[model samples]
Target: MPANIVAQARGIVKSFGGEKPALGGVDLAVTPGKVTGLVGPDGAGKTTLIRILAGLMTPDAGEVSILGGSPAQRLDSIGYMPQRFGLYEDLTVRQNLLLYAELRGLPRDAQEAVFKRLLDFTDLARFQSRPAGKLSGGMKQKLGLACALVSTPPLLLLDEPGVGVDPISRRELWAMVAELTKEGIGVLWSTAYLDEAELCDSVYLLSEGELLFSGPPADLTGAIADRVISVTGFADRRRLALTKALDRDDVIDGTLQGRAIRLLIGEGHPVPDAAALDLGPDTKVAPTPARFEDGFIEKLGGGPEGTSKLAAAYREIPPSDAPAIEAKGLTRVFGAFTAAKDVSFTVPRGQAFGLLGPNGAGKSTTFKMLCGLLTPTSGTGSVAGFDLRRSAAQARSSLGYMAQKFSLYGDLSVGQNLDFFAGAYDLSGGDAREAIERVTQIFELEQHYKRNAGTLPLGFKQRLALACAVMHQPSVLFLDEPTSGVDPVMRREFWTHINGLVRRGVTVLVTTHFMDEAEYCDQVTLIYRSRQIASGPPDALKAQAGALTGAADPTMEDAFIALIDASDANRDEEAEAA
Candidate 1:
């Protein structure tokens, strides 16, 4: 190992009674004052490697060194924050910090200084007295990071710390980590987010259990530079165009960005012109900058092929003039705090609607109210033309819901879970068996039919959740962060099914923190601080933000941040005027 390397691993391998090893002959190094990104899909050995590096798990075979010493002997020199950080919900932020200080064996005299520095670093000083449970998702993440830094270890291990966090909070978290790295702390950031990898000093791309690529993200991104392009003039049929592009032999991957279709052509293929894609004569194709995700998908042998079979089996709903979903003056109050106030939106027969906002925003609360999971303190809503308050049961029966977290029975086998869901949806006998078989084939779950749901990879779990949610083929679907924390390829596959459903006249209402995902929605309503701030098509929102940011073209994330900042400024001005 080099003297400058903070941590090193050679030929590390691990297995958990599976036919394949969890980690196979992996090698990596982390150096001071730099971020080493551990990037991979689910079941790619990232967590296993991080656990071994943290001395929490022993690798079956490998030589691991931390701070120039064995991991077991250098435990005090590394700080590890796992996926679910251990934070006592009842404890105050200060109390949690003090607890971690004690666990790290810091002296009482040194606790106050360390706590103060971490609180300031994370910008959580003012909220130190608040209970951890009361904090927003982003604030909780910051407090977790602060606890991990109480001992000020030289090496920091973060395992998907940005998962489920909004763009604003994600940027803040990254900024905090960057500051720590400036103090010579080495950071190993493991994440499914490729954009986050683009920010690292260097990245290690892992697939299955082996190392696929290691070096600067730009190296991989540059490999596909000439093959990336964006196409316009699809008008309102962009989703259909994207679907068509993904089926092409030359197109490796494609996604909807505002009103444009971003495509990555296959290697050795010529840059696709508008005519080559069977697009209209007015369609314009122009070369675009390649992204790390473009390279990641290319390296993964391209994303799922063809259209979704699951969508093919969907039966179109009967024609109706009524909106599929409607919410008017909906409000929910918890004691003195209002979670959602005067939130309103409407989704047509087959449109994909999005609810987007920062953590602790009223988006989820409003979503729950529409889903009939929570009763609003005032106002009314409806789904599939059924009143949410007067006909809640009928409204619920007309919809399918996939929660933010996988809500399937983990202890049950894949087949068992499918059967249970089918029965719950009133599917029985031949119908139940047919529905289960259909989902099993479409989701490629036949091989894992007997496996425990809990042991499946994250991607498979998401697929199963969707399968369970849609087996009965309800007229409307409610998805809460359906693609959170999944790899890019998996997300694309999930959206394929969703778009297919939308095309079949199945309305979808989704809430997500991923701004890119929001672009897929026909219309989006952004809720901030329990009030609707913006509602329009993705391109319109981006145009509004582009004018504000003075950018020729602005991304959904750029628009999201700009809109929120503008809103806060207006609120401040209103307060000053008063």
Candidate 2:
């Protein structure tokens, strides 16, 4: 007996002008009322397959059935959200909904009810009159989602639904997804965040255009549950232990989590005892449970922790006596709106400094001022020891910047973009050719050089953007939410390149929503409502916030939320007093 399948694909194959096909003989099925996850590395064919399911593109060789009918026939009954949802920013939220509703041919009676339900569920009712362009990043994403759901289709195809959203908004979006499935609407969700995959009823793992495995998320990781282990060594010997562990063929992957090293070993591989690595008698070793990430990384051949030799503090910048970055009483304004207010901070040589805040919290304004893209309305700032106001050209040349959007030339091939950026650094002929070759290999962009920058998967685009930004190896690097839509596996690899740069004495200032990634920073500065809220080491900030919240120990995410809540409460009290 066949299970109740809402959508199915067999022998799916697709090619996008490459030696390798985008999808190679893949298979998948969607069950009623269940969320099916499609996850894989960038260019693993997730988007290609989703397009096929949505009837936007046809597979070169295969069969696809949506609701047990030809995909074309069921197009009206399906709701699809692309990675970059094309919401008309100039239109008001309600206007956008009206457009989608009209397209679905919903009568006035149905349209009113659909609008009410979508607005309520997405919590966009209050902002329905606001122009979509005026909304925060998170709000815009929610409005886009509401537009997709306005039709109340029986099936949903969402590609990376939570991209670039903060954790709280991300949770809210997932909650909405869960409710849709409860109404017996089958959903196919593709996500870069592997943790989200665990929430799906079932998952299909893709890699290099083929299905590697398909089953419950736990089943994928739990098979090697006993192989995951934690090894504790003295702080002095931790690096040595990591080197030795990674040198072994059995050690699949390892990372420094807190004070201990967590290892994901292959099946049948013995746990790495500390004594084997020449650690003192005080070393502790214990088995740890495997996670979906462990299995995913292992299956994908994720090896040895990634860190860049050039970016990981391998060498010191010559003649580096001044601080890498300095900001003093910086302020920016647009008419009556104050985007950044009296912000001040500093980053010394060879340090990884993190800047974090929620959407529209003045982060972008402040970043722009520091990058010379926008002049501060008042006060001053400097990058790479050059005053942004007085020496803008030197400051610009002394640093590399990667905007949150990846800021690549959409129409250019990967090689062309690299060549253009390389030219900006004054490299040409043999020098430009050498730099391009080096970065292409370093970032594993050799195969993607011919691909259009904008057409690559989000993860691959992230790698290319970073490669282009660092082609000149500037002394200071500013990355704004660089991992917004990337997966956990790729994030780790991206940081390997960053850490390598830090080691080479390059100064780094990064903004990110992933608080866990903030743990890698030497210091973190928190901003809220255009003002600096807190600044210090990651652990210290968390502990202080934990004390205030009455939690003995709080994770970074919890501490961040606590700070925002506390700060808002204080501001309210102050307003009442005034």
| Best of the candidates, lDDT | 1
Candidate 2 regions with alpha-carbon error over 4 angstroms: 1-3, 230-248, 256-261, 278-287, 304-315, 319-321, 428-433, 446-460, 544-554, 569-578
What TM-score goes with each of the models? 0.98, 0.90
Per-residue lDDT of candidate 1, residues 1-578 (tens digit): 68799999999999998899999999999999999999988888999999999999999998999988998899789898888756999999999998999989999998889988998989999999999999988998899999889888999999999999999999999999999999999999999878899999999999989999999999999999989999999788887898888899989898888788899999999987889888776799999999999999998899876487988998988878999999999999999999999988788999999999999989999999999999999999999999998999999899999999989999999999999999899999999999999999999999999999998889999999999999999999999999998888999999999988998899999999888899899999889999999899999999999998898989899999999999999999999999
The sequence of per-residue lDDT tens digits that candidate 2 reaches over residues 1-578 is: 14588899999999988889999999999888999999987778899999999999999999999877878999887888888857898999999999998888888888888898899998999999999999987787788778878777888998887777766677788889889998988899998777788889999999899898899998998877888888885664444455556656787777655355677777776766767645568888888777787888878886545435444423367757788999999999999999999999989998889888888888888888999999999989999888999999999998889999979898999999999999988889997988898888877888889999998878889889888888877888999989887766778776666666776678889988887777667788888999999998877888888888989767677778888888999999999999
lDDT of 2: 0.83
Model 1 clash pairs are none
Error of 1 at 236 (Å): 1.7
C-alpha RMSD by candidate, in order: 1.1, 3.1
Candidate 1 — which residues are off by over 4 angstroms? none
For candidate 2, the per-residue lDDT at 563 reads 86
